[model samples]
Target: MDLLKRRLDIAHVIAREFLGIQEKGEQNLLECWLQEDERHRMEYEEIRQLLVAGEEAWKELEDGDLVAAACWQELQREEKRRSQWWVVWYRYASIVVLMLAVGIYYFAKQESPETIIHVETAAVTPGGGKAQLTLADGRKMQLDDTIRLTFKEVGGTDVSLEVGVVKYSGVDTADRKGAYNTLTVPRGGEFALVLADGTRIWLNSESSLKYPVAFTGNERRVEMTGEVYFEVARNAAAPFVVEVRDMDVRVLGTCFNVTAYGANVVTTLVEGSVRLNRGEEHITLSPDQQGTWNGDKFEMREVDAQSAVLWKEGIFYFENDPLEVILETMARWYDVGVFYADPELKNMHFSVKIKRYENINKILGIIAQTNRVRFEIKDRVINVYE
Candidate 1:
């Protein structure tokens, strides 16, 4: 056989063997291919990792033809690098990155009694990551394209609405009289803002923030629900305060993320210092520290702040998270409702990183790949069962 054909035959054998469907007589052929050269062993290991641990990358299969074509192109590129002596083994490792991706598609095709998908031609599209802004005067604007506007006297101040950001350039600590504007991000949407004080804010899906059009009083305060990441502008004189549920996070020029939804209130400090005021009790948090307020008390612990803010960077990071938690989060971002046929499935754990824009079905597929549970989507509702 020609080199290309030989490689193709070897790949077929390896794939079949890995799937445990190779003929009894094919074991010798697979063993010989592995032992023929050191390069073969290395390639097999790379493909094995792709099959076993490439769930994050395989998520793109939701795009159908585009994802399939991309995986094939990546595999071919890896095969081509085999002819280059100086390319090094590590360089071609990327070629096998999508090897398991192709395997997933093929595995699903065999109608393996294990993998079950209920819908045909499922196309529940992802969100576009946009939010609606309500001006201080009760005027709601859908921020889609670029536009600039000056608010007419709602707070007796001029607030500039440019693009998707609202900036109050003229600082009026004196205008404690300004109106407070609210920004609401509906389910399956996200938004960013540059506050009047130059503080930057990123709002996740199903969240809202209420802020003044201009700074006022001795402190700058904003009320938030759901989740938000903030880079507070430095103003030691006028501390920035975020009110979430029953907790008040007071900071003077700091970067932090706050998640307050349902009955949970979590504050993660990324930089600077923050004090959480829960009624009469005050708790201080330093960098890399997280505080979770459970109704009546605050619990503090050191954590990986980057993971907490991953949503702001357009990624989903789950570290051994419970299945119910994962479904709750995905429900917000995908605008779907989650129902569990077996409540015990909520205890299952998963760890994976997925892009925010990926289709919901692919994400569910990743969970289903664990083989511990199955999923069905009907009218934007996901039903899970084991």
Candidate 2:
């Protein structure tokens, strides 16, 4: 028991030194001398108890954000102190060295920028491809062209954007029959639109939206594959609906996000009531509530809506989204296929907010810090390992 207590005392000092709270001194050697004396061992126990008490004080946390920050800061301070005592206590230097190596490895990973995912067919990537839109007239419009048209389609009639969101009425489509427009958002692609009803829809990568030039009935509907963020125009006479896969969402002109990429579909409402149904399961949501489904059943709960659909604004938000969800987004945005080395790693969860422009390596580095897992980017492919 004495030996065990002595070791714990030494571990407490090393932990503090590793956290960087102590000042510069003899390093590991000084730490070794302290372990030879029983009196010093007793002092070490005292210090350990103090540290334990401090940890307990933190247990009564109120705000999660503040607690996380405080915890991280305390860890950092302790590690810094541990570093100075490391050389003095050469016996305990191994732990200090290991942590330092890990921190240094993190820095090295950051220095090496990684390529964007799956933009290329192979792991060693090339460049991404551009998206093409098929207008209702069967005309293909390459978005890369210099000729930019504004008055696209608004409120079943047509309207144009003068500048930012300035409205210019569209000409009557009475000359033609019901026309369908196929808008494809290729990998690494995104765009904004003013719907026929003055609604704004932002399309993310690997997404496609099909809509008619005008609405003929009391209900407005559009087809979607992938994901979209919408601000519906208020129309009491006609409600707006989005149909994708097995899910259909009815909205009365409010803001919401819909992710119906494949078998799973998630609809999160920001403001206004939304009626969602997947087959027989139907649920109505108030603001801040989301419906999660996968063709079989539907569930509603409160969620962080921004994190659910940040892709629409050219930002990626991860609020404890699992590896599966993150990989799905990565596959869509970077246009790559993921091969798992082990099944367990696929279930790991991470929380990070990143912009689309940052290279894959930066995000991977952030992820590696939380867990022992590491990511290696080879051209267009990323290898994840624990």
Candidate 3:
């Protein structure tokens, strides 16, 4: 046999070994292949590990008929290409084997038949750019990714929406009494805004920002709830300030992220400088520094500041975050409710990085692989059990 045919035959033998249907001579052939080279042994070990890990998950599959039909189709194709039968067989075999390997690896880790409770297959789509803008006059306007238009604000400032962003220009700075506008992003939505002063802000799900139509007087200030990332415009004369509950973040020209959805307020400085003040206590943060105000006192730590703004880039980046915290974030982005049957499950920590646009199942599946917890979805609510 040719080199390619030999490799394909070896792969077929490996698949049969996993399924416990290998013929008598296949074991000796696999051993010979493993002994031929160190790389072969490593590859064989890797495939074996995947098969073992996914064994339990494979048993849970309910598509036996579909699998049998697919196998039959592959067999038919093999007869038509007798000269390349090994190649054709291995091509389809590898797909089936790898899919089984991946599914098992993700769903069967340390899982036992008695421990398997439930798994929901319902799909939940990801969030997108959507928000509502409230003018100073109490007029509400819906803004989404599809619509693009321009209009004048209450203070005669020109506001325009284009490509998922709202921009404010032609500011009447002379009118010192600037009218305010509140941008509210609901659950499963996010939006960006450019203030009249050229400052840029990105709001996360379930967030709202109240800012002036134009930066007037001696300072540029905004009050917000939930989470937001800011790129402040440089103006040494008028420093920018963000008010989040009891905390105040003051900066002249910088990029930073503030999370204030919970009792604690976290400010992560990406570049330039920001001073965080809560009543009498205050602290300044430099680039790559994070400060948290926990209602009573302030705690500062050095961290990867850029990671805090990953939401704006359509990425979910978690670093050893607790299950409760991660679920809370998912609740906002996926617009789903969460119920924990076991309180202890909330304290489980995990480090994960994934695209925000993926279906909720894929994200939850990553967690379920641990086998420490199981989840069931009912009417858009996720129930967790341990």
Summarize candidate 3's per-residue lDDT along 67-177 as a digit string, tens digits.
644655665677677766454445445544544344344434535442443445456679999999998788999999998999986557899999789999995644646
- Residues 199-272, candidate 1: write the lDDT tens digits: 99988889999998787679999999999999999998999999987779999999999998768799999999
Error of 3 at 122 (Å): 7.2
Residue 131 Cα positional deviation in candidate 2, in Å, after optimal superposition = 3.3
After the best TM-score superposition of candidate 2, give how far the Cα of residue 339 lies from its true spot, in angstroms.
Answer: 2.5
**lDDT of every model, 2 decimals:** 0.75, 0.64, 0.82
Model 1 misplacement above 4 A: 1-116, 120-122, 145-164, 172-178
Clashing pairs in 1: none
TM-score winner between candidates 2 and 3: 3
Best by TM-score: 3
RMSD of each: 12.3, 12.6, 11.1
- Ranking under TM-score, best-scoring first? 3, 1, 2
